[model samples]
Target: MTTTKRFFRNKRDGKWLGVCAGLADYTGIDVVWWRLGAVLTTIFALGPILPVAYIATGVIADRKPAELYRDNFNPEEERFAMQTRRAPLRSLKDVHGRFRALDRRLSEVERGVTTQNSGLAREIDSL
Candidate 1:
């Protein structure tokens, strides 16, 4: 099954309400960094607002499904998903560039093959 790139509370890796862990999973950052940031923000800056938001997020967000990362758990796929989420247009452009490169390479190969063997080229063209 395909997993949607949606944020879910990672209770399995959480310390308290899974908020920090969830944030880490969603943003592709380390959980420790998220925890540290939350603590520092709570202690120094936002204070009540941060805590309230955390709690609200914990309450509102669904618990991460166990199977979400189980099937086809590729690190590259995860990174791509994170990148797509963070900057969709950039991801799309990157994909387009890759496809264009691949098309150029394939065209070069076809040109080479056709130039070397006219009969093979005719057969390929017929197909």
Candidate 2:
């Protein structure tokens, strides 16, 4: 994946802006690695880098719009861009809010299936 996202929250099934998974998705690195790295960086550096990087990424990274998936992207650049970029909302719990928003749409699909079956039964009864 040559095309990288400077900063985008990922649409991951795993959670949060899907930052970790997205990071994993982009770099082909496991999300575990990204999490570990982030924690280690914070622990060792102690104060400045993590906070500063987060602030910078908030400004620099790109948002994940539909446009990104228009073509087959490598996601490698996007991976580094995220790791280098900023906070990207690093937890699955936090990103769950975005995924939660899709609940209505998903329910619509689920409901449609039952409704369709009911309609078929009604049509049969009418016959």
Candidate 3:
């Protein structure tokens, strides 16, 4: 099954309204980095502007779905999800490349199994 990637507030892991946490999730960055950036920007740079934007984002963004990562907790899956969210076309190309490699490997295995190649059988038996 395929899921459309969208930004969602991660209230479960968030300290505030999950804006920073959502940003972390979306960008594959640590939540601490997002929180620190927000705090630093609020204090040293944008002042009230940053806070206002954060509040607006919290209010506007949808809460993360409970079933979004429900079944498994795989770090690789999370990384892939983040990459897909960040650059979908690049992710598509990566998946296509993986499938192509797998197809090539499978065809080689089929050839080895279907043909009566003594050398290939001896090589398999040695392993």
Candidate 4:
């Protein structure tokens, strides 16, 4: 027996409630196609049923984890997360190096400020 991943609303790709986007992610189909199909179905025979179903599903489904963090979705952050997941230690090391460099720069700025002449003197000199 195989287990399927539970479907969640893909708030990142979705324009509204992300029902079609969620369906697309779950079924491995393009979101545009799902949206087109939904609209056509809603306009043709299904009438209001499809839209109601969509709304209900959107309300009931959980938001995808990627979209849960911020007010708006960011695909770039998701891509970064995936890359970091692939090489967590390397990513951590890179981040640490960047923070260390920033720390060094800040320390230099602090030292310069502490040892430098007064702001009034510098202003007078610049004139």
Candidate 5:
């Protein structure tokens, strides 16, 4: 199953407007890397454009949900997040496999339920 991940500004860890923090959250990169990259972009004649983009992103991105801050990170979720950062397509295939397994298990449950209902119907008819 493909689930959507919302991009939210990480207010708790942010230094300035949380643009770098948001990018780190989305890309699974260390926040320092993003900050360094922003500085490099500014130095490399990207100039005011980089700062403008950061400001625009800060304005555009939504703040992270309160519940997410409260909830503890599950190991599976963390692993999946890391894997997605490394290889998104590979992780998608892994998700497909998991969904297929779930589908098979659901079909088995439906079959069992149908069988039990039919047996009960026959018992009622005989009685």
Candidate 6:
């Protein structure tokens, strides 16, 4: 997974654009839980301050692109991660095994790309 530098309006506790969701994306926390915490924080002890902050955040902070919430998350920070770069594994148990697997896959892809380029070069030479 490529690590895209995401920009989301997280000026406050959030629901849509997954402000909370975007936060979860950046922090590796569960979105549902963060949302709950924000809700609880607002409801229990704070004045209108929390709610007002949420509104302000909505207006100010960047919002995640609606479609990007899916598996392929692309956001703007001018730091778009390469697709081939693997995102940190959610867990090491399954992750350790995949490194070798990924290396093999990348190697194969590299071979194919290199072959195509070389063939193009050869054709140019012939011309």
Best by TM-score: 3
Candidate 2 versus truth, CA RMSD in Å, comes to: 14.0
Q: Write the per-residue lDDT of candidate 3 for residues 1-127, one digit (tens) a residue.
A: 2244578898988998999988887776778999999999999999999999999999999998888644666768777876887788999999999999999999999987898988878999999
lDDT for each residue of candidate 1 in 1-127, tens digit (9 for 90 to 100): 3335678998988998998888877776778999999889999999799999999999999999888755656778777776776677898999999999999999999988767787887999999
Query: What is candidate 4's lDDT per residue for 1-127, written digit by digit as tens?
Result: 1112568888877999988987766665667999999999999989999989999999998988853445554766655454464466887898899899999999999988888578878899999
lDDT of each: 0.83, 0.59, 0.85, 0.76, 0.80, 0.59
CA error at residue 50 for candidate 1, angstroms = 2.7
> Cα deviation in Å at residue 121, candidate 5?
50
Q: How far is candidate 4 from the true structure (C-alpha RMSD, Å)?
A: 10.1
lDDT against true structure, model 5: 0.80
User: Residue by residue across 1-127, what tens digits does model 2's lDDT show?
Assistant: 2345444655532344456555664555667887778778888866678756755654465546665553654565555444443445463444576478788779998898757587788999999
Q: Once superposed on the true structure, which residue ranges of model 1 sit more than 4 Å away at CA?
A: 1-6, 25-33, 117-127
**Segments of candidate 3 deviating more than 4 angstroms:** 1-5, 26-30, 69-71, 118-127
TM-score of every candidate: 0.70, 0.37, 0.76, 0.49, 0.58, 0.46
- Candidate 5 residue lDDT tens string, 106-125: 99999987775877889999
RMSD list, candidates in order = 6.0, 14.0, 4.1, 10.1, 8.0, 10.8
Cα shift from native, residue 101, model 4 (Å): 44
Clashing pairs in 4: none
Q: Using TM-score as the measure, name the better of candidate 3 and candidate 4.
A: 3
Error of 5 at 23 (Å): 1.0
Best by lDDT: 3
Decoy 1 TM-score against native: 0.70
Write the number of the candidate with greater TM-score, choosing between 2 and 3. 3
Worst 10-residue lDDT window, candidate 2: 9-18
